[model samples]
Target chain A: MQLTGGQILCESLIREGVDVVFGLPGGAILPLYGTLPQYKDRIRHILVRHEQGAAMAADGYARATGKVGVCWATSGPGATNLVTGLACSSMDSVPIVAITGQVARPTIGKDAFQEIDVTGVTLPITKHNYLVMHASEIARTIREAFYIASSGRPGVVLVDIPRDVFQEKAEFGEYPTTVDLPGYKPVLDGNISQILRAARLIKEAQRPVVLAGHGVLLSRAMDELREFAEKTQTPVITTLLGLSGFPQTHYLSLGMPGMHGVAWASLALDEADLIIGLGARFDDRVTGDLKRFAPNAKIIHVDVDPSEIGKSVATAVPIVGDLKRVLKQLIANVEPAIHVEWMAHLDQLRREHPSLYIRPTEKLLPQYVIREISEVTDGRAVIVTGVGQHQMWTALHYTFKEPYTMITSGGLGAMGFEVPAAMGAQVGVPDRVVWSIAGDGGFQMTMSELATIAENNIPVKFAIINNNFLGMVRQWQEFFYNREYSASGYTKNPDFVKLAEAFGILGLRVTERSQVRDAIIKAMEWAGPVVVDFVVEEEENVYPMIPAGTSVDQLIEEPQMVEERR
Target chain B: MPKGPASHTIVALVQDRPGVLNRVASMFRRRGYNIVSLSVGHSEQPGFSRMTFVVNGDDHTIEQVRNQLDRLIDVVKVSDLSDENVVARELALIKVQATPYNRSEIIQLVDIFRANIVDVSPDSLIIEVTGDEDKVDSLLQLLKSFGVRELMRTGRVAMLRGANAYPGTPSANGNQ
Candidate 1:
């Protein structure tokens, strides 16, 4: 069929089975947007207020559906704005394809009106990128982009299309049935010997713990992981991105294990005879000090990315393959072993150093707010959180039964990720409820999306945990910097209720402890994008923090000076 | 990270495509991998480019740099040649500040190293030298005592001496 670059891009996206696109149109990207009407029946384009939100929305959608989420932006600033979202996705291995418009070929490097070397700028951050100089390359590039974005260890792929190229005529051909990337062949299955070795290690391990990660969800191997854990009777410790990868309420599930992880999980990691790391990188956040992390463990690391196999720690067994396939192979070859002593020790520790909640207080606390939301949603709502105290509160409190239900910026820890991601989640899973939990500082970072929510009528419920301070950073300052409080507290702030109201969305505020549930209930019920102002305690801290550069064992249970003052 | 900057020669085969070289170079620059020197050319394969780079970094940084390099889809394979017994050479054109008074001494020095004087001007002699990095560094160090005008090195290209890493290896020397 005869088609221009614009038509070809739209048709190619539809051919690739893309149902939704999140983006804001600009001058260079107008041609593609012009062709949107022709394919509107097959594709839905959500107009985000900012390109960053669009990119993040795509990321959210990808996280929820395991598809390559697509976003569009124009040249220069629009392209650069997607950098954060691209980097965030790359860090966390979420597959997203961000299409940006470029200046006409002739003026690309001449610093024309809206031209920047976006492909060059995004080189390090993206999984891969291409700048389309010809219209003929559009279809193949889109196919390749989606293929690259969704394959093993998925990541963001960007394609920059020139404006003139978008207007050029080309022949639209059939979509390639398979990717022709010879250089990108990821190992899909572990060697039999390695799988057998892993099984032997599991059977012999007296104090074994399975360190699960995002790869398990990425591979859709939750069942395999659960069965493997069940067959072996091993306690599972989840990384930040690995949350919801396992049923957190299961008997062997030891919530999150890292810097701010559950005390028992970290302790298990410290004392384990064998650490079976499944698709989890030994990220700095997960291992506070590398030298002291899992000192007693004979490590077995399995991941599709060969680079991550022995990058951080020396391992006894390194199996570089897809987590799903490796776990499946091991399940067939392995014998189930129960380490009663290990489970008992972990249970005893968990009971001894139980997670504490705020004592009965008149002031509405942040933890209570998150707990109440978890209680109401009950694994039905897809929870997205922005980075800060609220994010930790959500991770520690929420019990997500299914995989990929909790989407936060685990690797990059980017602020302002919640609203747009929640929008994408809601759009992807319209039948399910979507909640965006943001800190006061982070909520304002991308709150411009409130207009997007109102414009799209996205029906996303937002909970702004308003503490009037950058709570996390302030907590750090209070503990380490002698409480000088440099630029941590807000000198002035917008009233969130009024702000949401201004965007033409339902707005409510809960100032006292008694109003928490009712306010959340009101927002959940009145949902055409409702924002709840949760005015939480001004001075709250996420406790059991492993101070930076220290071992996991040396955690500060409570803020010293603050507790003394109290 | 180690105590001092460690130099490593990394050879990589990459898909020959538009902006691929820029992609590889930009990755190094962005990730703070200091490229001491680099050279690239078409390989034996029609659609592949072979790149050899001399990077200076600590142990940890270099490992990460190599990992990041290999992660790019264009990169077919990355091999670090630091510990391998290999044939390595670098070409350098050093124009030395030689005069009538010291021309003979410079000629002797060049002759001792078996370097060729490619061009001789009124006040300077351009000497072309090829050898390993240590020998190249020694000649340059020797020239430093004299008035060395300018120098340029084509960086280093290397191959395993006896046999390739595997059959029909992309690391073969047919492209050279």
Candidate 2:
């Protein structure tokens, strides 16, 4: 059948089983947008307030469903706006395909209105990118883009189409079953000898700890990870992104270990004899000083991405392959061993320095807010967060029971993520409760998406931890820069409840301590979308903290002055 | 930054693609590894190209770079030429300040290195030299004393001396 490039694009998406796409229309993208209506039944297009939101929502969708997310934008400004979101997705290994309209082929270099070298700009950030100069390349290019994005290590793939090409008629061909990417092969199966060597290491390790990371969720290898942990009786310490990889309530789960990690988790890392890094990169925040980090431990790193294997601390055993497959192979060959003493040691540490908050002085603590939310949701909601003190608070307080249940930007730490991302998560998993937990500062950055939420009618719960300050940065400044609060405080903040009301969401505020539970329940019962503005204690800092750039021993625990919180 | 020029030669096999070169160059740029010299051309394989570039970095930094480069989708295999005993050569075209006076002496110096006089003018002769960096460096040093006019050098292109090739190439198992 003869069809325009736009129709061919729709057909290609249909073949890929794409049910929904997020985007905004503009001058160069008009033709594709015109054809969008015809494929309305096949693909639902979510109109985001901005291109950044569209890209982030797509990322959120990808993370929630473990499927490649698709997003679109017009040329120039629209494409440029997507760069940040795409970069975040790239850094975090979320698979997303971003399509941008290009100025017509002839006008590409003429500095035409709304023309940009988007492919060139996005080259470094995206895993791969294509600029389709002809209509004939669209179907195959899109297919390749999707395949490349979703396979191997996931990342953003950009496809730029010139305006004229989208309208140009072209001959159609059967979608190729395979792409001839001669050099794109990824090692899926672990080398047997390497697996054996790693298994032996696990057997040998007396006080071993497993560092579970985002890759566990990406690979959906949490089950395998748990089995490996149980087989070896290893305690698990999750990275920030790896929060929900293993059940938070499981005995094996030592919780997150890092800069803002619980005292017990960080101590476990410091004291462990072996650290089996499962799908986790030993980022600087986690390993404060490389030489001092797990100084007594033998590191065994298992990850799908080969580059991450030795990028941080030198791994004694670096097994590069799919985590699920490698873990399976390992479980089959490894003999079960008991490390009761190590578990006892970890439990002792946990008891000694539990992540508890009873800051009696600070009336509405953020930790309290997270706890109440957790209490209301039963720790089962797909909780998403913008990067801040609140993110750490959520990680510290919330009880996550499953993989992919906690969605947050781990590596990039982009401020305004979860609002749009939570929407995408809600859209991806319609039956589940998706919550966007944002700090006041982060919420305002992309709060424009409140309109998008209203338009889509996506019932994503929004919990604004309205601290009236950039909490994380203020904490840093308070600790590091001698309390010089430079541009961190929000003196004249907008009334969040009124703002939510303006966006057609039932907005409720909980200022007093007694109002927390009632406000949460009321918002939870709201028919459609709800926003709860919990005006939390202004300066209640997240603790069990290793002051930035400090080693494990330098943890700033509870101070003696006044026994303030007690 | 004045980092000691720990010149390292890295040879990469990459699938020939429109922006592959830019991708490599950009990675180097991002890593703050200044490329000393770079050369790219078709490999023995049909659709693959070999790129050899020398960068200034310590061993740890270079290893990180090599591993990161291999992570790129288009890159097939990457090896540090300096790590292995290999056949290495660089081609240089040089124009020396030569008159009728002492012109034959310059030709003698070129001939000693097994170089060819690719071009000649009354005022100068452009000598083409192909050798390893040591040989090329020695020739350039000797010619500089004679007041060289201009010079251009390709970076080293390297291969294992005996029965070895890049991982997936036909001759990877053996030179044959």
Q: Which candidate is the best by DockQ?
A: 2
Query: Residue B40 of model 2: what lDDT?
Result: 98
Q: Output the number of the TM-score-best candidate.
A: 2
lDDT tens digits by residue: candidate 1, A353-388:
745445577778898998899888886578999998
Identify the runs in model 1 with alpha carbons over 4 angstroms from their true place. A559-566, B1-7, B56-63, B97-112, B138-146, B162-176
The models' CA-based lDDT, in order, is 0.86, 0.85
Expressed as tens digits, the lDDT of each residue in B32-143 for candidate 1 is: 6788888998888899988998888766666677777777899888887876787889999998898899899989989999999999988999999999888888889998
Q: What does DockQ give for each predicted structure?
A: 0.34, 0.39
RMSD of each: 3.4, 3.1
